[model samples]
Target: MRLLHLSDIHGRVDLERILRAFNELKADIIVISGDSESSSLLRDLAGRTRVFYVSGNMDSISVVETARELGMLLDGEVLDVEGILLAGIGRREEHDLNRIRKEVKGDWILVSHYPPLDTKADIASSGRHVGSRIIRNAINELKPKACLCGHIHESPAIFRLNDTVVVNPGPAFMGRAAIIDTENWEADFTRI
Candidate 1:
């Protein structure tokens, strides 16, 4: 399946631009990783395309509720889409490694708002690794097929941990996004 991965919208409201990108990319699924203030807009987009999302630190409970009602909230759960198992873990003050490990089945996909620690995608502007250690540990333990994440806007990259590919699409408000072809596990991050 073709998937569009986006993150860190941060209250930007350009539905026409977003939809144009969506249509131009020809994606079957849109996976957002967080920091969006456009829950209502996302709810509308969910009617047009498959949208699965996890809330970021900046997201409020109301946004979470709206996404849940739209069937697009993917926090702390496992969703099966066309035979692919996706484990969703939204941004939280504290992460639960045990819970994440439990949700990971063979070759699963991980959708998170925080990038795993120590990867290229986890570097901060201060050069410190401020990502989630729990996520890194879970990845080592579970060995998922790919982990799609964001939040570290400066670190937009695609890297590998053993067989697992890690991707951060950067901040979507900055016009960064990624397209993942699940058939070959290839992720191409671009300026959209």
Candidate 2:
């Protein structure tokens, strides 16, 4: 399966160009991390692709409900896509970790809004590094095949943590995204 990953739209409605590019790529799944201002955009997106979304800090309960109504899975839910287990953890890193610790099973694909701080991949604008301790702990324990995240708009990195590949797609509104081929388990970033 081929999947498109994007994050941090932040209410920008000019997604048509980006969506067109994604469509041309023929991706089977599309994942958006968070901070979308309009739930209508989600509905528009759902019309074009199978989307898995998580509510970011800026997302309202209404957006979550809209996603639910459209059959979109929220954070902390696992979706089986062609034998690959795609799981999402919404916001609040600590709470997400705790929930996943108890419920997650087998090798899976994980998604989140904030990139963990402790990983060598986590770098700040000042060149200092910071990440989520809870996220790092969960990665160390659960050992999923890969993890995709956003939040820190300036810090986008792909890191190998033991057997897993951790990727931050950065800000989609800033023209950052990734395409993952599940059949080969390969990922590539694209900026439009």
Among these predicted structures, which one has the highest lDDT? 1
lDDT of 2 by residue, 58-143 (tens): 88888878887887755767778778887777866666666667666775887877666666446777776666666677777888
Candidate 1 per-residue lDDT, tens place, 1-192, comes to 888898998877466677777788888888888888777778777878888998888898888889989988878778889888877788652443445666668657888899999889999999999898877877787888999999999999998878888999899999999999889998998666
Q: Score candidate 2 by lDDT.
A: 0.76
Model 1's lDDT to the true fold?
Answer: 0.84
TM-score of each: 0.93, 0.89
Clashes per candidate (backbone, < 3 Å): 0, 6
Off by over 4 Å in 2: none
lDDT (CA) per prediction: 0.84, 0.76
Write down the TM-score for model 2. Answer: 0.89
lDDT of 1 at 144: 87
Instruction: Give the Cα error of residue 165 in candidate 2, in Å.
Output: 1.0
Relative to the true structure, candidate 1 reaches a TM of 0.93
**Residue 89 Cα positional deviation in candidate 1, in Å, after optimal superposition:** 0.8
